[model samples]
Target: MALLARRAARRSAASTKAAAPPAAVAVELSIPAHFRCPISLDLMRDPVTAPTGITYDRESIEAWLDTGRAAVCPVTHAPLRHEDLVPNHAIRRVIQDWCVANRSRGVERIPTPKIPLTPVQASELLFDLAESRDTAAAIARVRALARDSERNRRCLVSVGAGRVLASALASLAADGETPAAALEDVLAALVCMTPLDDEAARILATPTSLGSLVAIAENGSLAGRLNAVLVIKEIVSCIQLTGNVVEELVDALAKVIKAPICPQATKAAMVATYHLASSSERAAAHAAGAGLVPVLVESLVGADKSAAEKALAVLDAVLASEEGRTSARAHALTVPVLVKKMFRVSDLATELAVSAMWRLGRGAKESEEGEATKCLVEALRVGAFQKLLLLLQVGCRDATKEKTTELLKMLNKHKGVGECVDAMDFRGINRLS
Candidate 1:
């Protein structure tokens, strides 16, 4: 009995302690005003002085410059004469020292920031990398330079390193003895050169370089494939592609989309396809025949609004051809997916979806009345008629409404669609009747 009483007392005390609220720690740590960045209002990691003589975090200031959001300093509001940003090494050291001194307050010491390479320095590095006997080391150095800072990346492009990187990739492809690591680095460098200028893009658009990129897209690692796609996208966007180049891009992008290594890479591949397909009708037919319909349908089913919009646009372009229409009709989910997206995504997406349906329906109408009637019945069975009528009632673009009217009239002409039409409460149907 005595032991039992003691055990019960201990349990009650333990329960009380466990249920009690935790006490707040009262350590107050204040950051010195000089240590904070004027823009971010946080301790600076890499302080840099702009032309306005105001010190700000390097990333914040660079972002401001890159975005063209402001031509003046955030702190002084003085117009900048030039966009020169010099590193404030002295302030950085002071901030690091303060962090170290306040270590007990959970402060972390900031590492020394790497100095961004100048245009001349970047050119020299690229030259050495291209001429290096040690290919592996050269590749590693190139990747490190790319990962260093955005400023360095800009420097590389300013000094023509983009062309050098393209040449290296082309040479490697020609050698056929290039290591995977080296190839990946070259691809990464090219991608890092964002918004490639016309000169750099033309350099990468060469046949040998493009073939290498296609090879990488087809068989490289996930990162390599994504980089290749991104580089191709930039190249195609900046330069006018020739007939052969468009064919090559279509083939590579089609393969990448079929087994997309990643979601982002798939989106890149799709955008590239859209760019190429917009160039010619023959390219659209080629992309459609290369198994793009099913992939696009799959993407629409799972994509977010932006991705779905792009996918619909591509579908709209490609569906203009008979081969594209046939491929879309052959895909089991295409019609249902289009109907589902009619009013669910964006206005642009809606327009594109309705247009694709109009094209497909028109194609069916051209293939004998019986075949057209059968296709109309199938569309009605998938709730397409209800969605189209609702689209008309809710208001769409004038062009889209017109297309919707045509599609609805075509469907209502089918004798079997009477039941599908009656199921809708949309008053817009009276016009069709």
Candidate 2:
């Protein structure tokens, strides 16, 4: 009876006591009213000077001034003095706790996802852009891509994404943007590329296949059009990418080299062809087919020294090739142009001309040799020897000096050594050295 009575009393006590109020959940506020109170808005009282020699409000002065320049000091209306101010370190700690508590409400600044494009979609866009028929739409799309900051930002995040790169390259090609503008972007994407995507190859090949890049180099009026140097460099890279696009490159270069239209463009084209000649055999064949030798020979007499110099360089490069030998013979060229160019001596023109002449003179038939040799001797006899000897004296280390030596030796062997020697005396060649 005593145990049951005790159990009942315990049950009554548990039921009679109301459940204690649920434990209060603590809520923190970040900016307290005191800290946030602007000194400019509050009245200053009992101002005391700190080490900075400025008086401020005593009670809330230091607290309000804690955030440097966030509020004016209590006494001064100017911006709160930064040096005299100190941060409320405890506020940051409280903020950390508050952030931890409200993590679900925190805004995460995550990067936006890019509009994912596929290889097929990228290729289709490129195909449309590359078509000559849709040049306007293609250009508009490219301009839009350039202006679309959001899309570009997302693209930057997905730099190595093959589809994005293909689309970007296609856009650049379609717009015909200047090389300087497009080159850096393309190179950046290319460095990150994992494998050359099929879309990338197709888009890249589009321009090379079109053949107008060379034409533009040949005669583009656009302000920053791709020049000959850049064109050849790109074609070389394209050759590496496309494998045996040399034929296409050759045809384009030939077209530019042979285009008789714009002299500057022609000069630029020849310069490009000279660089290309440094690499491929097809350049030699195509240059010969396009009648490059005769054209350059004509440019020698042109008024523009720049064009003439470029022409001479190409001629020199051309004569070094086996096809050049055939071209030289088939044309039955003369040495008068060579003689005139040798006297140029402006830059490398004289040296190139002399070298080209030597190469062309290689293993000439007896009759051809007689004709050239006779003309060369006549030039010497007519007081050309003095200038040749003077050229030898003035640090002529290239083909000019060597050719002079050969010509002097040849004159000696023409059984007219003594007569030529006497003529040299009259022309002051004997006194030059």
Candidate 3:
């Protein structure tokens, strides 16, 4: 009886081991070979066929091309003649069917991939939109197209659709017509024109077109405002602005930043401000006067690293002129905010913050009993001297250290606060002494 029980136990143990391999095998069998991308070795979400007769995910293949690797088929190693990647619809349908059949196994259906817009199709769509009397339908269609794949966006730009849309916007503005729906659609399409070419940017930068965008920024829907700001940022990056245009741009950016729109729009506004201010001191002063300094100081209250860095950079640019320095000094939180950011953010932010402080300090020393002295007093009250001592002791970039040394000397001269520096117990202060 004991021998029989041991034999039965051995048989059960062998049977349990045999059952374990089938679960993994079943999982392996569920994924069809054709569904996998050769490049990524995963189930393709958006498969396209290369000219070499092998299918791959569109994004994966685009990244492959972007890397400038050998122009050979990854699978068959055949020399690729052309880079055209056609959608493999048959395989996609098969994969969908397989997913449906496996629904009981918790397999989710892959969404149908959006068809990319071709240049011809984009041109025709632009013409239809231009002539369409149904404004709502046109807006919906434009939004859908803009939200589609990246390839469609590139095609829209290549087919001159962006220029046509800008011209339409210009005409609308010239006639003093502001159909909210149509304007939103046009602005959204312009945003989709990533890498807006010089000509497209020039068209959008015109006074009429730019004013339309500003109007959208002021009164359009949140989506419209976000897209407008983004398009403006892209346009500013590609072109140079001067005189009234720069002033208008800065004003629009300030309004958007002050509004309760989305974070993306705010970030876009901040970036646009930085770009415009960096272009020239005139633009920087204009931006500062447009309530940019106070807005940036408030933005730093709870800003992330990237946003804080950008804000500091814009502040630095704005502080280059006497007017900009005056504007910054007038803001109650300017010195404390910059002092707070000195070492708390990135090294780049530290450098920019230090430079801005140096400028403000230099301006204060040159003053008799004016706003500059007030700014200096504000700095001291905010513990700017103590923070500067700590920054020197903790050690920073070489340039930052040098600027900190200069700022300390200037502050010491004004306040005669040599005891403040003497009270700090940092090693770097000893080096400074």
Give the number of the best model, judged by lDDT. 1
The lDDT of each candidate is 0.78, 0.50, 0.76
lDDT of 1 by residue, 1-433 (tens): 9999999999998887665432111123567787778877777889998877788988877777678666777777877523477889899999888878876656677899887777777777877877855756665676678778777777777777777777777788777787766788878877777777787787778787788788888788889989999998888788768777688788989988888687788888888888888778888888888888878877787678888998988888888767788888777677678877887789999999899888777774455445445556767866788888888888988898889999999877763754645453434322220
lDDT (10s digit) by residue, model 3, range 1-433 = 9999999999998887666543343355567778888988777778899877899988788777657888777787777633378889999888888877876555667889987777777777787767855644654665577677666666667777677676666666676766766777777766766666777788777788788888788778889889888888888988888778788888888898877487788888888888899898788878877877887777786788987888888888888767788878877667777877876778888889889988777773355237765666666655678888998888887888898998877776657543343443334222210
**Which sections of candidate 1 miss by over 4 Å?**
1-28, 51-53, 81-83, 127-139, 174-181, 239-248, 368-372, 389-402, 415-433
**Of candidates 3 and 1, the better by lDDT:** 1
Model 1: how far residue 340 lies from native, Å: 0.6
Report clashes for each candidate as comma-separated counts: 0, 0, 0
Per-residue error for 94 in candidate 3, Å, reads 3.1
Every candidate's CA RMSD = 7.0, 28.2, 7.6
Between candidates 2 and 3, which one is better according to lDDT? 3
Off by over 4 Å in 3: 1-30, 67-71, 76-83, 111-114, 126-143, 279-282, 330-332, 364-405, 408-433
Q: lDDT of candidate 3 vs native?
A: 0.76
TM-score for each prediction?
A: 0.81, 0.44, 0.77
Candidate 1 yields a Cα-based lDDT of: 0.78
